[model samples]
Structures are given as C-alpha cells and as structure tokens.
Target: MSCQEPEFVTAEDVGGFDDLWSSYGFYNEGCFEKGAPLVLNDQQLFSDFAFMDDMHFDSISSAISVAAETDQPASNSELLQLDEKSTPPLPSKTSELLSKYQFKFNARSGEKPNESIERGGSKLSTEDFMRIAASFFIQLSTHKDCNPFMLNNQFGLSFSGLSSAEIMNVELAILLFSAAEKVSQQRFDHGTNLIKECYKLCSKTGNSVQRVVYYFADALQERIHGGKGTVVKAQEVMKALLSNHPVHLATFRSLPLEQIMQFTSVQTILDNLGSAKKIHLIDLSIKHGLQWTILMQALSNSSSVDYVKISAVGTSEEEITSTGKRLTSFAEILKLPFVFKPVIVSDIKELKEDMFKIEETETIALYSSMDMNTMIIKPDRLENVMKVIRNLRPQIVTVVDVEAKHNSRSFINRFTEALFYFSAFFDCLENCMRGDERVRMIVEEDFFSPGISSIVAAEGSERVIRQVGIDVWRLFFARYGLVEAELNQWSVYQASLLVKHFACGESYSFEVNGKALLVGWKGTPLHFISAWKFQ
Candidate 1:
C-alpha cells in the first residue's frame, strides 16, 4: 500500500537505441527524468512509437490471434497498415492439455443494454434497486467467469428508478468512474455534468460517496488531461473505498483469466526440482492461495512430491491465515505432509532472505505472479533485492509481469504507452464481455479503472502501475548475475492450453524471447512469465 523509494545511481546511456536496455525503458535518472514540464529531449530522439506486436484483437481469446514471430519495435507504416484493416481472424487449436485444467468465461445478460445516455433508463418499481444491486454484487463478486458488462444496461435504468436526482447523480458517478475503460466522450460528458449536479445538491463535504466521486472525477479528468492523474487523492479514495466495501478487493478472484499461466510457472519450477527432501514454494504475493490449490492437486496426484512446504506472504494476515488453513485442510484430505507457513508483511520489501527459514538442504523455488517486479522501484532496489534473492539461491525464480512499458519517467511517453495498451485491453474486454455489463462494471471498478488511474496519475514511487517488456527484466536478471531459465515447453503449452480452452473467440499467442515466454492477445504482449536461476 505504501511506496518504497528505491534509489539508483545516475548512469547515462549515450548510445540509446543500439543498447539492449534502451527499448525496455531502463535508463539512468539523468537520461530519462523530465524535472517538471515533461522534457524528453534525449529520449525523444531514441523514441519509437511503441504499440502492439502483430496482434489482431477479437471478442474473446478465441477470436484474438497473435503472430509470435513479430517482436519488432513499432513503425509508422505498420501502424498505418494496421489502422486500415479489421482484426485479422487467426486460427487456434484446442490441445489435450487444456482439458485437465481450463479457466472458462461466458458473458450472459438477461436483457440487452440500451443505446445511449440520451435515452434515459427504464423506470423500476420502488425498492427494486436494492435487489438489483444485491444481485449485481453476488453474480459479479462471486463468479470469476461473469461477463463485465453484465449490468451495463442497468446504469441508466438504475438512474431512472431513483426517487431523487441526487441519488441518481451518485449512481452516475459510480458508473462513469467504472466505465472509463470503454465509455464514449458523450457519456463521460453527461456523467461529468451529473457529478457537478451532485456537488450542488449534496451538502456533505466529508461524505464517503462524495469523496469517491470527486476522487474518480479527478482521476478521469487527469487521464483526459494527457494521463497525469491525481495520485494522492486517488489512493486516499481507494483506501477509503476498501475500508467501506472490502469485497471490492476480492473481485479479482472471480476472473482468473491469467491464473493458469501463473500456476503453470509455479508448477514448472516445482517440476525442475531434483531429489531434494523438502521442496519449499516461496510465494511472494499469495492472495487467497486458490492458485496454490491447483498446484497442490497436481502434486497430490503424483507420488513424487513427498514433503511439499509453502511460505505464503501477503499484506493481509486474515487472508494469509485463511489460505494457510485452507491448504492445510486440503493436505490433510490428501494425507500428504504439507506445511503451510503464512507470513504477514506490511510491504513486500520485508520479504528478504532473512525472513525465509529454509534449511540448507531444502530446495526452494521463488514464485512471484505479477507482483515481485512492482516491489522493484529502481535499479538499485532491484540490485539490492536481487542480492537477497541471490543469497537465498532459489533453485528457480518464476516471475510474471505486464508487457506495456509504464516505467518511463517522462510523462508523455508513459501516458502514450498506457493509452495504447489499455485501448487494446478495453477492446478485448468489449469483445469478451460484450453482453455482460454487470461483470464489466466490477472488473473495471476493482481492477482496470484503478490501473488506468494509477498509471496515468501517479508519479515516482507512487506509480507502482509501471510495467515493462521482457527484455528489461532480462537485463535486470543478467545484470544481477541470475541465470535465465527459459520457461519449458510444458509451461508454454499450459499457457496456450488456457487460451485454447477459455479464450472464447479471442486468440492468444505465446512466444519465446531468449529465456522468457511472452503471452499476448492478438499480437501485443499482455503478460510475460519467465524463470531465473542463481549463478
């Protein structure tokens, strides 16, 4: 929740593009940071418009297709060519590996959504709105596979049913804030006017709803103003919202679009283990531990894994305890000697070699699915963290990170990249969650909305939303002397299996760059999972 200011020495990169790390957006402070007004004089010369790979996005993962060979830096010609045509329909195959473990999603809407905000929502009977809200929360918060747009039509419908325009304003505020990913300017403009009306109507300056509304207004406004977000305000509102509606945070579990890849990466590390006695799975950011359950089942099925132990680290002690107990119960059921060691840390930085109590003889595998890299604030921090990890000498360090370059100190470049990345993402969501507006609302409110705001608004260490390509991580690992272990064929196949089984019509492509497996929708790299070993 708090940011760690990782200090780095200013080492200049004079010959920018030719250097390996240049395209990856890992440069010294002097080379990248624009003091106040975004000045990227040096970076501008080396800059190329970064966009998707040879990606043609469709409705679901089935329709989406990727050309794995196209990892080239983007060009104007390519962009122009891409602009002219619709997403090229690419073919995908359903492998046998998908049948055993597949994450599925289908957008189901009871009634079709309306055309626009111009035509106001249909009126509902008195007190029916509460039932609707309850239904929305249950179906969305509970089910991982629910379509995001499940309640899309309810936005205007809910507004129409409210007794006072004041409550309607509040509802509009929530919808507009959540729908930033795929709403038109006209709808956004109408929501803006409603927000202004709420300010005029409601007297409570400290009201929680008012605060959330204003905070989202600021966040959405900042994105419109070239993606410079109101970070402090956004975080404050986010903290407040989490305090009031705790379940909002758990919305991620319902939609396990990428969990299959994460588990595969963990299983791959587990598979690589030799004849070690106690195999320790060190999960840096273990949330709910459901992903671990999948790996545990795999381990239980096999007679090989004798004593499987885990060190589950998380920000929430309650979550850790519950996950630990859950795993222990499963292990008891399986009758395997499994030890669940749950560690509570305020920050992931607290996760160092000293925190781990593994015996010298035990084999350890570090599993970080979409979190460990964010702990790295700067190059110096990475080096320091790498030292700790290096000391631990984990047999394999599995990492998964977003592909878009969000690390650029320069605002303009960072904003542009984020916009491009999210646009494709929104389009993908639209295709996948087309009819399910209700599910779309939850996904946007809990996940994508915050991501957009955080990336666009926050600066420096506060901008933990930063993501980079695999090459950058390749450099960091290589620099720290951690040997890159290419994700195995089985791991890659597992990833492809998820896409094959669950992608609906969306196509997902997996490519290997050196020692990393890059998984992207259409052609743009969404997530990259890699493995490393200590030299």
Candidate 2:
C-alpha cells in the first residue's frame, strides 16, 4: 500500500535477464506490505457458526459420507438435495467465513460463483469439485487446533462415497495445502513428501483441475528445492514460445481474450492519434508483434497517414528481428510506408529515451499487454519503466492485462485467489475450445503454466507473476503523472462484436469501468484494457 524509494540499480549492476531470472527474494519493499492479521472475537466466531446452522453441517456431513461410500456416482437428485442443504456460501458470506476463521479471500467480483452449480450429469464437473475442494481445504488448513491428516477422526468427515475423480481432486487439494503449509513453515522434507504424494494424484494431462493442481504441486516442489533449474527451463520454454510465430498466431486466433485486448488497444491508439500523419509506436513487450498488424491495416486505409514506425522493445534480438520481418512484410502488402525498429533490452528498467530515437514531429503512442506485471517484483525497476514512458510524452498509452489479485504476501491468500482466477480461466478455455484438446493444452501449458508456477512456487522478488486489479494500476500510474484516457463507446462496441465472432464468445462479457474496458467470462472480469495520457 506504500512505496519506498529504493536505490536504483543500473543494467550493469544486475547482469542480464538470465541473472534477473535466477535471482529471487526481491521484496516489493513498502509496496503491498502484508497487513496485520485479523483477530476474531468469540462473539464473531459464534455469529459465523450461527450462519452455518445445524442443518447445513449435517447435510455436508451426510454428503461427504455418501460420496465416499458409494461406488456409483451420486444421482442428480441426491446431489441437488445435498447442495440445497449445504450450499456453497455466497461471495459476501464466504468472505465473512474466511475472515472469522483468520483466512483471507480477496478473489475478484468476477470470480464469484453462479447462483446454482452447473450440473453435468451424475458426476460433479471439475469446476464444481474445485469450488467444493477449495472451501473444504480452507477449513482444514486453517484449523490450527486440529490435525488435518486425521480429518475423519478429528472432524468426523468421510471421503468414502464420492466418485473416484472427486476423491482424487480433494486428496490432491489437501496434499497441496499441506505441502504449502510445510514450505511456509520451512519444513522442506515434510513438504517435499507431501508434494510427491500430490504428484501421485495430479496429472498435467488430466482434466482442468488436475492440470492446475499438477502445476501447483510442481511449484511447491521447486520452492522446496531451490528453483534455479526450474527457472532456467521456464526461460527456455518462453524463448521457444516467443520465437515460434505460427504457434503465437494460432494462440492469438484461438483465444478471443487476446484478440479482445489487441483489438481494443489498437482501436484506442487509432482513436487517440486523430489525423497525425507520422505515428510512432513503442511496444514494451512486443513478442510477435501481431497486434501491430491490425493497426497497420487500419492505418493503410487512412489517406492522411503518411508513415508508421514501431519501436519494439524485447529481450531476444532474434525474436524481435523475426517480428520486424513479419510486420514489415505485412506493411508492404498494405502499401503503407513502415519501419520496424527492434529496441532490444536486457531488462525493461534499462530502457532509455535515446534507444527509441523519437522525433519531435511524429505522434507517439505506447502499448503494453501482459508485460508490466513482471517488473512489479522490483519497485525501482517498475518505477524506472514508468518514468521512461512518462518522459517519452506519448500521445496515448494502451495497456491490457489479466485482471486478478495475485500479489499478496500471504501464500495461502495468493494461492486461493489464483485458484479461483485460474478456475474461471480454465472454464473459459473449456467452453471456448470445446473439442480442441490439443490447442487448449498448448495454451494452458505453454502460456499460462509458467505464470502459475511463478506465482505458487517462487517467493519474494522471485515470484514474478504479480498481477493486480485496475484500481491498483490506476493508483500506480497516477503516481507517475498519468491519467486515464476514456475509451470511446465505439471501441467497446467493436470489442463486443469481436467476441460474438467466436464460437463460445457469448460467455465473454464487457463492462466500461470508468474509462477502462473489462472483458470477463460469464461474470468474472479476466482482462481489462485501458488508455492513458500524461497528466
């Protein structure tokens, strides 16, 4: 919640991207300091207990026992009865429960569950299991007075009647919780054992729940064993992913979320530039530069536009060069005079105004998508990046990022938030991809899995996937003398139309939060795109 001015370190002080990746334990300094733990009084505890009356507890107990003992899957009628008796608490009630129990639940409003569980035949859906298991684990993990391993004896809970899949997921959640607890307590050996057990039940190739649990377990294992090798391997995966244009393009096409971001960002840039004849774009993390193609095509139609230049900032020279070639080729086909400048940098904080070679006459616009969050671990670096942008005096800056609160200092809080956030995301993928397992797996494993690992496994500065909501970003940007540039109504309409073009796109919804545009699945806001200009 506060920012501490740390001594700035130059690129030479920190070796390169490899060194930055290898180094962990960089605290956020004063920013996002862990707040004092909430203490629950006896009266508050009684009130919370009153909310879960005897009928609810009895129904939950009966359901657990029935699910554990029965060989056949529970019928919809039976499940519905149980669900009615012991329904998952609503978001407000859930927060109260977590608070009373001395746990934190800061999941976004978009992550709230629907009024009713979406029944899929006799068996519970993966998402349903995730919700149940997450709640169950919360109770088990926070009960410091009782031993979680002896839940049957200590809490009178049974795992007998549930389906095999349900049992597997619940067991994995328990193991993961136990392992995380051990890691936090610095009991590496015990945590490692629990992690191994988690691996036994988890599968990256299994259902969405299993895939996510598998990655969480992997992260815990890495956390226990000093994750240098894991970091190196992740870097390799990212490098390969960035260099592969076809895969990137396919991902961009398959996922409407990316297109929503890219389209909205491009539209915002075009709208803000007016009739500028010469425009320069500075992309902070221009992986494959696919977004610019849309901008170039838009500009090609404008008679007043004379020249377009894109100064792409990235880590890999080869990848940037490759992206330049593609964008250059696309520009030629459109008959637009274009230049692609690859502004390669070892670290984003190393970015300087001189590297961009800006002109006095050219109108400047900056774009960032899922990039700024990485710089968050180091506040000074993030500040420096912001300073660079502010100094550039861009006409407009567009930013699109995943919308979630995953920057908590508390592991369990962050873990819970991530569980819900990714649960919604995975559900979105399942609905959108439908039968295309291959593409879904590629997107999940290649693009998202690394982020999950970083969030769960790494700690301090090493934990790089520190995504926050727009409210936090608004405050951060405001400190750097940037103000929100309202996105026009047409951009919102265009984004909605783009969503309709996809098969399951109707599930995706948009909202204009102040000047920003939020695209969410169902009711959950997964991403937000907003424009900014210097104050």
Best model per lDDT:
2
**Best candidate, TM-score:** 2
Where in model 2 is the C-alpha error above 4 Å?
1-127, 138-171, 186-193, 226-230, 233-246, 434-436
TM values, all candidates: 0.57, 0.70
* Model 2 Cα lDDT, one tens digit per residue, 1-535: 0011112312122111111101211112222212212221222112211211211323333333433454323332221222121121232222232232221112223333222112221234344456555444444433444443444344332333343344456555655656666676666766677666667667878777777778777777777777545555555454554454456676677778888788878988999898899999998878878788888988898889879999988778887898899899999999999988999888767889889998888999999887666555555556567768867989999988867767665565566567667877887887777777788887778767777777777765466566776765764565456789987668678878888889878778786676888888765678889999975
lDDT at 338, model 1: 94
**Looking at model 1, how many pairs of residues clash?**
27
| Per-residue error (Å), model 1, residue 446 | 3.6
How close is each model in CA RMSD to the real structure? 17.5, 18.4
Clashes of each: 27, 12
lDDT of 2: 0.63
